[model samples]
Each structure stands twice: as structure tokens, then as C-alpha cells.
Target: MSDRIIQSNKEELYASCIKRKMEGWRLAQICAVTINDGFEMSYTFVKDSDMDTLRICLKEDEPISSITQIYPCAFLQENEAAELFGVHIENITMDYKHKLYRIEADTPFKAKEDA
Candidate 1:
């Protein structure tokens, strides 16, 4: 199946997710990539045989709304993203409070600055 990508801003995240869900897409995965000063979040969804991805770029301090209301299984992915990348995912159905991983340092994926 082919993959389709859609770029979205923070404000449009929730609505875009709702549209996808209404279109019969099932949430597949949520992932984040560390950028210079922020992170790029990708929400992947699958419908029929095709995969659709919604990408949103967010600053370190920016908070993203949880899609758990739309896809109940999203809490796990949101928790991982929050724990590993330090992205603030707001209103998640279940917040693991960074207990998803037992690492010594938080935000392990954050880029280090020469202090």
C-alpha cells in the first residue's frame, strides 16, 4: 500500500485527527523526531490498505493534544513520546508520568548543548 503524508500545525492537530477517524482510518502509530530546537511528531493511520500520516512540528515547550479520545490506544504512544522526547502531550487518557521507561535521565532523545 502507498503512504500519504499531510503536514499540520498544532492548532489543526485535533480536527485533522477527527477527520481521519471519520474517514475510517485507524490510528497506527505516533512517533517523534528530535529537531534542532523542537520535535516533529508523526501520527500514522491505516485504512483499508493505505497508510496516511499527519506530521506536526512543535517546539520543546509546546504542548500537543492527545488523540486518545479519537483512538483509545493512543495513550501508550503519547506516553512514550512524552517520556523519550519530552514533548508535552496534553489531556492524554492515561499519563504514565514518565514512568514508561526507567532511564536515569529524562528527555533522553533531546540534543545536548555544549555548556
Candidate 2:
């Protein structure tokens, strides 16, 4: 395993996606922040013990990548996030298994209309 890291601004994040694809690295996790100006997204790369971690950040209304094409495990992470944080994950082929909660609405953070 080798270590690789790249830091990019909002406009350069697409290049980061291409780099992740070229390296065949999977996505370990994704975190985002909702601010008055915009949203900040951070995609964490799946790293091996010897491989260095890659963290890419950007502020976009909606951003996406196809790291799933290289690493299939990423779909689960993406799907869970989509349901939790309301981001759209493209190219997901299977049902999203919610390992975090027992039973919840499509949007876990959404307050039930009847509630």
C-alpha cells in the first residue's frame, strides 16, 4: 500500500475524483456542512494501513463522483449518506441497508408530518 494525498479547492474537486478513480481507491466516508453561503463536502478515501489518506473538500450545491466504479463498497457509504444527509448518490444498484437505525423514514432527519 502506498500513501497519496491531494488537497483541492471547490473548482479542483472534480480533478480529485479523477485522481481517486485513477488510483482505484474506494470512498471510506463523506461528511458535509450546511452553511449560509453554501455546503462544504469532504470525501474521505478508503485507505490501507500503509496507504496515506486523501481528503478532498469543496463547496457546491450538489457534487458527485463515480468512485463506485472503481470500488464497489463505496455504494453503501454513499447510500447511507444520501438517506441521512439528503445527498443524491448515483449508480447505486442495491437496496440501502440502514446499519445505523432500526427503522426510520426515508430522510432520517425529517420530522414526520403526523408527529
Report clashes for each candidate as comma-separated counts.
Answer: 0, 1
- Point out where model 1 deviates above 4 Å: none
lDDT of 1 by residue, 10-94 (tens): 8988998889889999999999999978999999999999998889999888998898999999999999999998998999999
- Candidate 1 clashes: the total is 0
Residue 10 C-alpha lDDT in model 1? 83
| TM-scores, all models, native as reference | 0.94, 0.52
Candidate 2 stretches greater than 4 Å from native: 1-15, 24-26, 46-63, 93-102, 110-115
Model 2 scores worst on lDDT over the 10 consecutive residues at 52-61
Weakest ten-residue segment in model 1 by summed lDDT: 105-114
